[model samples]
Target: MREEDDKMNEHALNPSRMRGRRNVFCWFYSKCLDAAIEKKWKHWNCAKCEQRHNRQAEPEISLQVNHNIAYYEVSVKY
Candidate 1:
């Protein structure tokens, strides 16, 4: 840890770092839980959850790198 831990500091953010660490086989939300659970949706729509939710309601993941660890924690900067 460094002295800066005592205070919030500005840092650049990137998403690529977490992309490599993600489970490629995983879906943001499981298919079984989809609204079409009974219909058995055969194909992924190739959409940003076009069939899932609105743009704003879609979930988001953020990666924060601290000493090479990510998803460790995230915060909003005032």
Candidate 2:
């Protein structure tokens, strides 16, 4: 009985055991945003060096639309 209690305490104290759900949601959100960005722009160059040139200039509405599409795709898949 003591061993079982100790095991339960160890499991309860372990921080690594508590973060799986949050990590999965964060990963999905990142993937959805990345897909939206890729789909909206064509040049796909580094923003820091490229200075927004050679890219398909889109309005904010278009970006929001693409983001919604990508978010729904991710949500439906998983």
Candidate 1 regions exceeding 4 Å error are 1-33, 46-54, 58-61, 69-78
**Residue 68 of candidate 2: its Cα lDDT?**
39
Write down the TM-score of every candidate: 0.23, 0.19
lDDT of 2 by residue, 13-67 (tens): 1222111222222212333235436566332322222121322223335434445
Q: Residues 1-42, candidate 1, lDDT per residue (tens digit)?
A: 243222212321111211123222333333323523455544
Count of clashing pairs, candidate 2: 0
Count clashes in each candidate, considering only residues at least 3 apart in sequence or on different chains. 0, 0
Model 1, position 77: C-alpha lDDT score:
100
Per-candidate Cα RMSD to the true structure, in Å, reads 19.6, 21.6
Worst 10 residues of 1 by lDDT: 11-20
